[model samples]
Every structure is written in C-alpha cells, then in structure tokens.
Target: MSLSAITLLGAAGEAPTLTVVGEGVVLVPADVVYVSITATVQDENLTVASSESSEALNRTIEALIEAGVDEGAFTAGRGRSVSTIQTASRVCNNSTCVVVSDGAVNLVREEVTIRFDAREEALINRSFEVARSEGAEAGIAGYALVDRRAAIAEAREKAIQNAEAEAGALASAAGLKLGERLEIFERSSPLIREPSYAFDPLGMRMTDLFDLSWPVAVDPFETASSAEPGMMEVISQVFVTYRVSP
Candidate 1:
C-alpha cells in the first residue's frame, strides 16, 4: 500500500500495511511454587549406611506420592559412597621401604527431589510437614506461575507499537511518507537470571543459605544465573523495518 493510503488508514482507525510494531506488557501473578527436599545420611558402615539412607529416601518419596504429588515431580537417586586413600613412605637407617597406605572413608548420602504445584497454600504447608515426618527437610525451592505465552505476546505487540511510532515519526521528519512494513524481527524475552546466585547444593542446606523474598527480579534479557529471580525486571525488545514512499 502507498504511504498516503497508510496514513489514511491510520486516520480512519483501519489496520495499516505499514510495518507497525507494537508492544504490550501484562503483570502476571505467580500462583505456584516448587519445593525441593534433600536428605543426606552418613554412617560408619558403608553397607548399613547406604541401606538406611536408601530407605529414608524412599519413604520421603512415597510420602510425597501418597499426598497426591505428581510422579514426574519426584526423583530417587542411588546413594553415593566415598572413601579416602592415603600413601606413606618411611626410611630407617640404611634401609628404605615404601609402604602403600589407604584409609577407610565411611560415608553415604541419598538425595530425593519432589516437585508439586502450590495451588493451595495449605497443601504446600502440608507437604513440608510430610517431608519432616519422613525424616527429610524441605522448603520452598522456587516459585512459578502459569504459562506466560499470552503475556509475552502482548509485550511483543507493545514493542511493535513503539517501533511503528518511531518509524512514523522518522518518516514525517524526513519528509517521506510511510510505506508498508518491509520486515519485522522479534525475539522472545530471554529468560535471564542474576550473576550472583550460582552455587552447587552439594550436601548443603539450600533453603537456609538462600533468600526467597518477594519482588522477584529477572532481567528476561540479561543472560545470567541468579539464585532467586535476580531483581524482577521482565522486559522485551523488538526491531522493525519499514519502506519509504516518495
């Protein structure tokens, strides 16, 4: 369509063929949370320790399952055993002897992961209790909401709108009429985290160590890893190209 036609459509409230990029954002509230409970068992006898740890892990998993937790949300991994080795050398008088030495490391750990929806706060609370009852410690691992596809689309539209306005203003200032949209390039808001929150939870109390407060900040653009949704800024950007009519 011609630039004049584009202008006319804009004036008449009709969809213009001009490459108009719009952006919109919607505040989406999260309604669900993911809770992860980890248990570690250590004993002197590797066999007895491993067996007991396995049983504890299983009981924890079964408890979660019995509470209507989704099977996909639960995981029971094999317990790991670790041993220490040492080497020593001694020399006396004119005779020297090399002795290979090793020490026994008696330790075993079992881990279980459970994921459940927080549709009900009471249910979440109950889950925590159940975990404790099963001799496992649990806490609010993370929070998530329903699919944000629609919200993202809305944000994309708003971005397109902003681009279109800029393009129109540019064309008007350049004394050239606006033309049809030649091309539109868009990318989804990248799911970004913060840089500071990266740590391995190897036999550590993850919940006690990290904070899970409100105002979850996520750049959605910066590609980083944050422990708790680093700073809560969800943003999207878009690029648009339009033709110019003489």
Candidate 2:
C-alpha cells in the first residue's frame, strides 16, 4: 500500500520540498490462544432442553476450571433458544406440497470463550478434552500477541527511520542538503491477523450434526496437535515532508 501526504512550506514560497512514504513490517509468533466451546441440547419439551443445555454448559465451565484455566480468562455468553419445526412433503401431480408434522423440538445453546497461554500446550489440550467429555463441542478460535502495543510502537519507529533515510538519500543524490523536518503523518498502523477456525471441525459427529455451513476435508482434532502456533505480521507506514537546502 502507498501512503500519501501534501505539505506547503512557508505559504507557497520557492523553497523545494521533499515528500516520501516509507513502510515497515515485523513478524511475530502469537502468545495467546482462544477457543470457543458450545453446548447444544434439543428436546420436545422446552424446559428440558433449556435445563439440559444449561447443565452441559455449567459442566464445561467447571471442567475448564479444573483443567487449570483461570476463571477470569473465560466468559460465558447469553444462552439462546429456538423452536424448530419438522415438515413433511408430498409430491402429487408433478407438484410438491408441504404439511407441518407433529415433530417439533426446542433447541437451546450456550457458548463459552476461553483464553489460554500459548506456551501451555498441555493445559490447552486438557481443557479441550474436558469440555468435549462434558458434552460440549470445542474448537480453536484464534490467536493473539501479548505485547501488541510494543510491537506496533517498534514498527512505527522503524517506519519513521526509513522515511528519514530515503529523504536524505534523495536530497544527497540531487546535490541538495537536507533541511528541517516539515511535517510527519502516520498513514497506517500495524494490523494483527487472527487465525481462522472456520474450516476446522474437530470430530466426525460434530461435522455430521452441526450446521457448519461448509464442508471439512480433514479432521481438525487429528491435526491440531501438529499445527504450529499462529503467525502474524505488523506493518506500519508513514508519510513525511522535509525542507530542502540548496
């Protein structure tokens, strides 16, 4: 991407101005991992469905706490309930007609988000295992860096240095001495790319039962252990204008 800026020196005076855009990038390993666990229950009775779903969610939370996850690092979202209806279809005279069937069920679902230290692989694995054993579906959500502000600051400084170096080089090549800095503008900041778990389905039953909305070619659970930590890049850009001395 390009950074652009405009500057006028001394109210349109005849002094030459140099404007340059510089970019900086840094790559870092993620320090934290996030996982979202969802528990679902369906029954003909709404009360039973809601109760079972809540119980399952509570068990999952307890299991995560037992697996050494800090309670503060996890959050439970509001529970959702929906009424699902079953329909029967009949084709007669090259036309299809649908009729509502007696088969109707209430579904209740609750979700919990857990944050784990990336370095603690054992605890992370155990947390997933316990959640799954407690009738919850678990999957990797994303990853994050611990010191994001520091990384961004470093990248921004590098961008400033790069702009200065380019400006000086251009001035020297043109037989002109670099003068005072006129203006500095931060065009962009570093961006962190979160890992996607949209395509990963841990178990076959999860794939078969849930409305994942996409097809999974591989089992995420079988390959998650071998998967490497998430990688992210920080990028910064700045536009600078400087005065020129003849």
Q: After TM-score superposition, what is the CA distance of residue 240 in candidate 1 from its true location, in Å?
A: 0.9
Clashes of 2: 0
lDDT of 2 by residue, 127-174 (tens): 889988988988887777877887788878887888888888888888
Task: Give the lowest summed-lDDT range of ten residues in model 2.
Answer: 211-220
- Tell me, by lDDT, which candidate is best: 2
Candidate lDDT scores, in order, read 0.55, 0.71
lDDT of 2: 0.71
TM-scores vs. true structure, each candidate: 0.54, 0.68
Clashing pairs in 2: none
**Model 1 TM:** 0.54
